[model samples]
Target: MEAVNLNKKECKFVVAVDESEESMYALSWCLGNLISQNTTNNLVLLYVKPPPPVYSSFHAAGYVFSSDVIRALEKYGSDLVKSVMGRAEAICGKFSSNIHVERIVGSGDAKDVICHIVDKIKADTLVMGSHGYGFFKRALLGSVSDHCAKHVKCPVVIVKHPEKR
Candidate 1:
């Protein structure tokens, strides 16, 4: 085993993850391609869930969503975060065991939350998967990776899967 830098702080690398396969691919790519075994690194797996559904005063026929239903939804969201993180950790384990892995669950817009967390952690690099949206689609729905690349202070890596043969 290589000797880790005892005096140096762990290099922080944040990977933005979602339910999409693209995001998973990005995590794998980051592990395989970007990280080196020589340094101690903090591999933060970040999942940003949309804010919990809001129950407005006005509903159709004055019907309101039940507390049980809301709780179930929240539970589902939590499960999803755990599931994704588990998959990410499995991938990381396969690639390397030198780095420390951490999971972060945030609620809000993905782009905003990712940028905020990257800044908060003072990450050395931000990695994300590209959905490979075309120009028109990207224009219609702003690309989170593009936004991060523009706004994040640290280096941003957007990994995209190769075309199938």
Candidate 2:
């Protein structure tokens, strides 16, 4: 085994969170286990909003309420991002208020956006929650954590909820 340093150092950790309970659990786990009060830790909370739906002026059902509906959809997405970040910040506050926390909202596929942001930020480690999908379901739907583990240069930690296990 390689020798590891336990001394305090500035470390940046990117945590990918969503509306799922699993993600929140993962965030909590990270705060409890990995973070230390003595160390300079940068906790980045990343939320990726799904790509907006492509809609024309007329819907498939021949409805012409595109602008109003699109605006509403956009507003909802923005609100959801704020809500998720708020929850995450609340969790962080419960953990340690001294730790530096950064919130990032990205719009795209979760896996791709996560990988890109991790690289862009030069994160020391990436933490995320596993959906706990079985083999067949994971194979069919593809796992974001799995893809990120394979693609990102940083070490990836996929936290499986206790209930999932």
Candidate 3:
């Protein structure tokens, strides 16, 4: 085992995941590649929470939401996100943690929110799985990985699972 820098903080990296095999595989791949044997670089695992029905807030100032309303939306949405995080942790534990993990859930388009978060955290690398779920599901998810790969300024890595035999 290589000596780890106990004092240095590593550059942040973002991995957008969902409750899917592709997402999990992608994260695991990133852990092995982007991370060193031991580093403090923040590895943010983000799952985009679906927006609430009554939680519509436009960018314009025309919409005003009460604090209580915001709280309720967050309260419910955050709970869901945390639940997903728990599952993510279980998967993460199976691998060695060369980087620190921080789970986040944002409500919006997965690609947009992911990009925003990447910028917000100044991510050194962004990793994701190829969007094609075989052939059928691929049409629906479109290709979040494809979108992010094109948009993000940071280095983007798309982890592709082995082709079916």
Q: Could you report the Cα RMSD, in angstroms, for every candidate shown? A: 6.0, 4.1, 7.5
Candidate 2: C-alpha lDDT: 0.81
**Across residues 10-80, which tens digit of lDDT does each residue of candidate 1 receive?**
67899887776777888888888767766787899998876443333334476777777767766777887
True-vs-predicted CA distance for residue 90, candidate 1, Å? 0.8
- Please identify which of the two predictions, 2 or 3, would achieve the higher TM-score against the true structure: 2
Q: Indicate the residue-level lDDT of 8 in model 1.
A: 62
Candidate 1 vs 3: which has more lDDT: 1
Q: Highest TM-score among the candidates is held by which one?
A: 2
CA lDDT, candidate 2, residue 139: 24
Candidate 2 residue lDDT tens string, 72-99: 8678778878888899999999984458
lDDT for model 1: 0.77
TM-score of each: 0.80, 0.83, 0.69
lDDT winner, 1 or 2: 2
Summarize candidate 3's per-residue lDDT along 117-153 as a digit string, tens digits. 8888888889877763222243276667778888888
